[model samples]
Target: MDDDTILVTGATGGLGREVLARARRTGRPVRALTRRAALPDDPGVAWFTGDLTTGASLDAAFAGAGTVIHCASDTRHPKHDIPGFHHLLAAAERGGTRHIVNISIVGVDRIPYGYYRVKLEGERLLAASGTGWTNLRATQFPELLDKAFTVLSRLPVMLVPAGALCQPVDRGEVADRLVELALEAPAGRVPDLAGPVVQRLDRMAAGWLRAAGKRRPVLAVPLPGKLGAGLRAGALTSPARAVGRRTWEQYLAGKASR
Candidate 1:
């Protein structure tokens, strides 16, 4: 219950795990919030069982936490994301949490994707929550793209969105930034973090196929309506804010080595 305690939700996720690792290195009291009842044996980290969607066990999770890195999200069931975030905000408010560092996707407003819309709403809710908050919008992660390609590869060919440009930023780099922002005073909507290069989805899929040693043909199929137009217009990219150092190729190389 230390005032300097930093709580990280969704500690088991790809981005959340990275954030938790970096936060632990700060030598401050770090609490990890997970929905699972079983806790890990990491002595340095205080693990709490909590579900953000239903606000279960959040009081203990947020107790005495001065800063919260709001990394917990339900991308699979985005409908639960908003309600979960609402619960998080309420818990933070009750705990007098000074800062809530939220991780959001780039082009949430520009993109017409359902998940992006959910993310945008989360930002709005945090801003209106009247608590100290910081939101960092970052581009897609290489892992996400890799997963998408992996699934598509099962169909004999990769059916990537035609003319869709993707900026795959490293999740670890994003985690570093989130931890940095969590330690500092609340700054509303900080500058975006994007990958070093912007490339079309087809090219990115090709790179994935090469890295994964797959022999699937890449097919660029244009999506109809606003989604296609939004992507073709490069709504997912942040050319001016390509602050991320790691590129898709580097990530692929590293993944191949592992």
Candidate 2:
């Protein structure tokens, strides 16, 4: 366990927390950045208070960090994405950081969604930054799918958009891969990591209902757009390279046990 510290942005979020926890298991010092000082105190971990919006704040957070795991993203509110990511990359370059590990979604370039477009732009910036970097593109998290279902299940019958393919991964597994990337030398763009099985969006919604002890009938409604067509045509799932360990059922079981 050397004093060489790895900096993790978005430390309070689900994937970020898992990355920090796994990084700490190696006994290496971790500097985790958050928007506020709400993280639990840990001796092995130092907290840096900063947001991605401000380049100065990000520069302060990157100080003394050898490697950076950039898990911070603004998918919910994409308006801040371009500027935030630009500032983050600039700050990392200024701080003389060696390795940068970035987490991205699979099919970001293929999908016509606004968030994915922003993510693709961010990836482009990192790729051309002249720094040692590895970008990990992964599928959606099972937790995220479950949360989406929970929100949609409020209706009398859940209406799933037809022609959407999904291969949701476990956040823990994605976290492990991101930490591994942070520790090792840069490998450029890595292969996409997906779940064990490719499922349709309607089926995934049904699975969620079953896992949560609910019985909401799922109806598939055809969508009329390129984004819907891409999703339905299995653009989001990778069949030959499904490399995840935890299945959706296993994730649900773990949640039930907890």
Candidate 3:
């Protein structure tokens, strides 16, 4: 890892932060690109302020980087994704980057959500970039599930989508995998990474509440559209490949221990 200078975009995000930390532990030169000027000071990381929508700022970010981890994504404002992704790919090409590693969500193809659609489009663009690339599709993170529980606990009765299945994974594990991918040659579209157990959203929520020492009624409401149907059919879960070892329950336990 010390042989190459790796650049990590979205360095402040949950997954990106872990990647940045892991990269630093490798003793390699790590560069981080963010939209903000001020970031936590780290001697191992060189911070560069840049917006993915504008290609001008990325010139300095990509300079002398052999590998680029494209974890930067727009979930809320998806309008900027296509242009931003295109610009990044072009920059990587021009910079002579050896590989591009992307973190994507599992079941993106089955879900019709706008964000997932944008992610699929990004994947397509990267595939056509002619540069070596690897796309990793992972399940929802445990932290997201924990956040959902916090919101649902506020209600007297939590309303959850019936038949919705999820295999939430650990963000740390996913970050480790991303770093490993960044170091290796691009193996286009690697195997999906997911949690060990397939659980209903309601059940997971209930367990989270119980673990947090809260009690709330769980109402399972069936969703009425294609999006709901996709979730209920377990399209978002990877049954053939249960890769991650940490379960939601184990994650909760670890949190409690901490």
Tens-place lDDT per residue, model 2, 1-258, is 222789998888888899999989867778898887576777888888887876546766787687989888766888687888888878777777888899999999888988999899989988998888999999999888888889999998999898689988889999999988887899999998999989888987887788788888999999888888888888788887799988887877776667
Off by over 4 Å in 1: none
**Model 1, 185-238: lDDT tens per residue?**
999999999999999999989988898988988999989999899899999999
Point to the candidate with the largest TM-score.
Answer: 1
Clashing pairs in 1: none
Question: What's the CA RMSD for each of the models?
Answer: 1.0, 1.9, 1.9
Each model's total of backbone clashes: 0, 2, 0
Q: Tell me the tens digit of each residue's lDDT in model 3 across 61-146.
A: 88778899988877679878889998898888777787899999999999989999999999999999998899999999999878
Clashing pairs in 2: 163-232, 164-232
- The models' CA-based lDDT, in order, is 0.92, 0.85, 0.88
Task: State the lDDT at 36 in candidate 1.
Answer: 80
lDDT of 1 at 226: 91
Q: Per-candidate TM vs. native?
A: 0.98, 0.94, 0.95
Q: Give the C-alpha miss distance for residue 117 in model 1, angstroms.
A: 1.2
- The residue-level lDDT of candidate 1 at 104 comes to 95
